[model samples]
Target: MSFDIVERSLNDGTPVELYTFTRSAQVFRYTSADEDVLYQGATFTAVPLSRPSFEQSQDPGRKPISLKASSGLGFVQQYIASPPTDSISLIIRRFHTEDNTTEAVISWMGRVTNVKFESNQVEIQCEPIFTSMKRPGLRRLYQTTCPHLLYGPECKFSKPTFQLDAAVNITGGTTLTAASIGGEADGFYTGGMVEWTNAGVIDKRFILTHTGSGITINLPFEGMVNGDSVRIFPGCDHVLSTCVDKFSNEVNYGGFPFIPTKNPFSGTPIF
Candidate 1:
């Protein structure tokens, strides 16, 4: 048996919930309010697309959901203001009511195709996962995961031993100022990662670039108000020297540090 929740399938599921959602080093989770003690008020209304051709019998695909941002939502407003610095690879899956055991979820993976901000809401359109599968995969090229690029088994990067959290004193405009964070004004925090929580709802992340002045950040955010939570992570340039000197994990370095940049065809031979 199947019922429709916001025009989407609620097929034979005792309880509906997302399994895992990880983006930009942040994961998506629920709160207490649901029967399962989750965020019960949170709703995902399915939106269906209009049928253009009568010749086609089947539906185009599953309707897309418009991302709504309230005063305290997990996904922020500024993210929709502009596309993220890196390409988005969001993976979403839903579990049926009774099949809510383990590894029982559906795929809703897709790429953001269109975004239109409408008065307190960011309506987005995404192409289906089949669109990605239809394209040429990384068959002949060097393939690697994000963990390898950041820090993983092959990268041999060790997480810093110290704390990275900071206390925000002032927040307005694109810059954020902190007073004596972790005992370093702007030295250690430079080039580090900043994970911020806004209004206890959405979480925004930005790479803290050093401005050579005070404890000011380069990236701009929407809800950069005072008293927001911020966590910092030590930066890694991913160079062979940096790996060897700071992390001392050069043995498992994933990059070819000695690869020459000089043109291979620069030399000419005379017969």
Candidate 2:
């Protein structure tokens, strides 16, 4: 595939305009109105071109030159010495492929003095660029109909123990936050915590621990959420905080180093 220059113009007599094809390839020819021209193939190899060098070539009353090249895989020839302020005309030719496909070629023409050949190709330099992270859609199983546990003073320490079962397949680091539905007032209970145990392990010691005080969970790489169930041991009273209060720490509540809420029925305490 290649592109060709189909038209040319001048803007404010400073920058020369060359309209080239966006797709395919073709050859472009340039003709001068005045002065004889000598042609030469660039001796340099593929050196990159820079934008700054072209800006310095804007001068009035200088020798005018033109360039021509084949549309696809063709040589570029440069002309030297013509009318200083004269505009050049060009003709573009497209080549056809063996598969009956026609391709347009693109060519860039600037003042011969403005053109620079570092090696054979134009060189480009750029600064570092930044990108944003992409997140996947939330996974749903069992039609989102699972029951939730509520932790608050109203339930006291006499309520029945609640259980939660969740299975998550983690490809990278992930976080999971869960809370009670609506047994107590909104944001009335302390967030729950997670204690993880590897599958098939006989020991009861948790492998990883996470706090639910913020109702937010963060899982690191190689993280697994198998058929895990959180068993809330009853006979324990607790409190929850609002999303805002949890972040700002506005109140002077001193519930740290969790203390078990007193049982209303048994008059005993569980932590």
* Local distance difference test, candidate 2: 0.27
Candidate 1 scores a C-alpha RMSD against the true structure in Å of 8.6
For candidate 1, which ten residues in a row score worst on lDDT? 45-54
List, residue by residue over 59-177, the lDDT tens digit for candidate 2: 41121332332222112222111111222233222222221223333223222222223344422221111111233355323221211232334223222333333333332333433
Candidate 1 lDDT tens digits, 1-271: 3333422544444444442234555544432113332223433333221112213324433444334334233443336445454444444544453432333344455555555666655554555556655675543322221224554456655555534565665544545555546354334545556666543434444555543323555555554567665775556665667666756776776665555556568784631
Model 2 poorest ten-residue lDDT run: 123-132
Per lDDT, the best of the predicted structures is: 1
| Candidate 1 clashing pairs, residues 3+ apart or interchain | 13-96, 13-97, 14-97, 14-98, 34-38, 73-202, 74-202
RMSD to the hidden true structure, all candidates: 8.6, 26.1
Candidate of highest TM-score: 1
